[model samples]
Target: MTQNIIRWAQMDDIHDLAYVYSESYRKAYVGIIPDEFLDQVSLNERDQYFRKSLSEDKQKIAIMSLDEKAIGLLIFDFQGEADLPENSAEILAIYLMKDYWGSGFGKLFLNWGMDRINELGYANVFLGF
Candidate 1:
């Protein structure tokens, strides 16, 4: 499979980002949450909120494809300052486009983010099942 290189999201990606935002979201959180609740969600809101979070969350990141495609993303940690004295962390979300699920991008992106976290002084990272 061709490797899709990941890069930090930019303003030009809002549209594709929104598409992947909803698509991957429908696959990941739709069933766990409720349909009506899911229907009420706004990708724009999530984008805006996460944009600010990314700007501020030094421990957090949002990545996309080099060709403006958003196949998947990995966001780690919370809203407040990280208190992990040992630098243990949580991978809040790491979702792939449904078509790319077993295509190796998942593993590639996961390890990429783990490497980032470790470079940021983290000893461990946790991903939600």
Candidate 2:
């Protein structure tokens, strides 16, 4: 119903990212990941991890927003020293709120991420499931 855009994650986005993480995980991973695991993924834990990740300065996070509300999150490992497969960075995770599914946001987000990598001058990029 509204326009959405994807952008890099910031400290200000931690809260909304947590919300999207819960919503998306419950819906998308229901049959793939253990229900208990999903249920146990506490916001506090995720917050701690996100905070720690922010501190790391190597892992990167991106969020998709609709009307300024965070709806999806993407994380990638920035490898400046050719740390990943064939010197290509590997995406760690990409999660989106179920409400955005079938609206073609996923591919947009993915392609946008790749473009970001390109912007960073990364000639090769890959994602791991």
Candidate 3:
């Protein structure tokens, strides 16, 4: 089995991260979200968003790679809802390339994110999707 690495995302990973996000969104949300909206998605826009995310101190955005190719993206933040516990963490999003789906990478990524959140002193962690 190929090894997978989960690491913090960098500026250079913006394009690959965008591609993974766009393709995964298109595949996963086909019937749920409007096709027109998905069609209008742009890699450049996603790249910009990720660029900003990388600079945010509160947000934790990470990339998962298998054999040196980026296959997924994960975003989490300590910003919690009012009703939630203090110092709570929320998993804003997690997306993987369709080809990697059901290959246990998702579980691996979730565990990795949870570990990081715990290390950051969060009292609770919730997954948004």
Q: Which one wins by TM-score: 1 or 3? A: 3
| lDDT of candidate 2 over 12-118, digit per residue (tens) | 78878777877787888898999888888777778877878877777889999988788899988866445455557778889988888988889999999988888
Better of 1 and 2 by TM-score: 2
Ranking by TM-score: 3, 2, 1
The runs of at least 3 residues in candidate 2 whose Cα sits more than 4 Å from the true structure, single-residue gaps closed, are: 80-83
lDDT value for model 3: 0.88
Give the Å error, residue 59, model 1: 4.7
Lowest summed lDDT across 10 adjacent residues in model 2 is found at 78-87
Worst 10 residues of 1 by lDDT: 78-87
Q: Which stretches of model 3 miss by more than 4 angstroms?
A: none
lDDT string, candidate 3, 16-112, tens digits: 8889988898999999999999997788888878888776656778999999899999988877778778889999899999998998899999999
Candidate 3 versus the native: TM-score? 0.91
Better of 2 and 3 by TM-score: 3
RMSD for all candidates, in order, please: 3.1, 2.1, 1.6
When sorted by lDDT, best at the front, the candidate numbers are 3, 2, 1
Candidate 1 accuracy as TM-score: 0.75
Each model's TM-score? 0.75, 0.88, 0.91
